[model samples]
Structures are given as structure tokens and as C-alpha cells.
Target: MKISARNTLKGTVKEIKEGVVNNEITIQLAGGQEIISIITQTSSNALGLKLGKAVTAVIKASNVMVAVED
Candidate 1:
């Protein structure tokens, strides 16, 4: 999945933690650093986020957001 963010970290997905009813998936990096990313509200195809899968985690600042009008 190509996500547009500030930075990207190339790593393997080590594990997945899913709740009882479509909970968020917590992807663990190869280096043992776990990052919790929300599965998009519209994504329901089950992209099979599994272990040992090569993936990229987009890193961005939390304080970056603003509202605008057209």
C-alpha cells in the first residue's frame, strides 16, 4: 500500500493484533519496534497484513493538520 506521508521506514511486518470485531492492526517492525496504525475506515478487503511481510511505515508529525475551504 503506497501511503503519502512525511517519511517512510522500510521493514518487515512481524506481527498483527486484531480485535474481536475488526479492530486496528498493530504492525511490528523487524527491529522489534511496534507502531500502531489505523486501518482506513473504507478498507475492508482484508489486504492480508501478515508476519514477515515487507512493508513501509509512513512516519509523520502528529502536530501537522489544518482546515481550509475552497
Candidate 2:
């Protein structure tokens, strides 16, 4: 599939929190980093998301905030 977003990362499904209308999915990348995505329940079911399943996280945003402490 073609996408405009470039921030795609390979990860494995770590957790799935199902809701009535939406499902919250957590993916664990290499080195134990984790990312969470809230997607539609229909889409989640279509993808058949489950634990330990390999997936890719695509991040698209207009603004990303970062902070550092010294």
C-alpha cells in the first residue's frame, strides 16, 4: 500500500484493549519501545489484531512535540 506518511516502524502487537466503538492497540518495537494506537473496532477486526502478531505502526501528524531535561 502507498502512504504519504514516512514514520513507519515495524513492531509486534503487545496488547489490545477492545471498546464498543474503538479499540486501543499497543505495539512493542525492538528494544522494548512501545506505541499505542486507537483505531476503529471494525478496522481492528478486519486486521485480526492479536498478541505477538507482527505489524507496522504508521505515524502521521501535523505537529510533534518534544522536550528534554538537563
Candidate 3:
């Protein structure tokens, strides 16, 4: 597989909030930061994203965009 992702942030799984079936999961990062991604409802178990579980948030610089309107 041609996978290209960079900029990884290591943080513990503060809290895993579940949504609807096969819905997105909220990933809590270090420094009290939160990120939401559309992942399987079972992702929590697959990645062991429970409390105190160390996980990495991979974010490519280019993949991230910033915007501002005045």
C-alpha cells in the first residue's frame, strides 16, 4: 500500500466517546486537544483507545489546511 502520512503526535487516549453505529470517534490528544475522525465504532477496541492508552495522531502538513474570513 502506498501510504504517506507524517507529523505524528503521541498522546494517551484520554476518553473515547462513541457515536452511532460505525460512526466517528473522538480522539483526545495531549495538552487537552481533541480531534474527530470517521472511524469504525470498534476502532476503540482495535486501537485500544481507552483511558491511558498511548496513541499517535498522524497528520500530514499538506493534508491540513487553515482558513480565515473577515
Model 1, residue 20: C-alpha shift (Å):
4.2
**Cα lDDT, all candidates:** 0.62, 0.91, 0.69
Candidate 3 regions exceeding 4 Å error are: 1-3, 23-28, 68-70
Rank order by TM-score, top first?
2, 3, 1
| Best first by lDDT, ranked | 2, 3, 1
Q: State the TM-score for model 2.
A: 0.88
Model 2 CA deviation exceeding 4 Å by range: 61-63
| Residues 1-70, model 1: lDDT tens digits | 6655677667766556565555454656667787666664334125656777677767775645778997
Candidate 3's TM-score reads: 0.62
C-alpha displacement of 62 in model 3, angstroms? Answer: 4.0
Give me the overall lDDT of model 1: 0.62
Q: Relative to the unseen true structure, what is the C-alpha lDDT of residue 23 in candidate 3, on a scale of 0 to 100?
A: 52
**Which prediction has more favorable TM-score, 1 or 3?**
3
C-alpha RMSD of candidate 1: 7.7
Cα-based TM-score, every candidate: 0.51, 0.88, 0.62
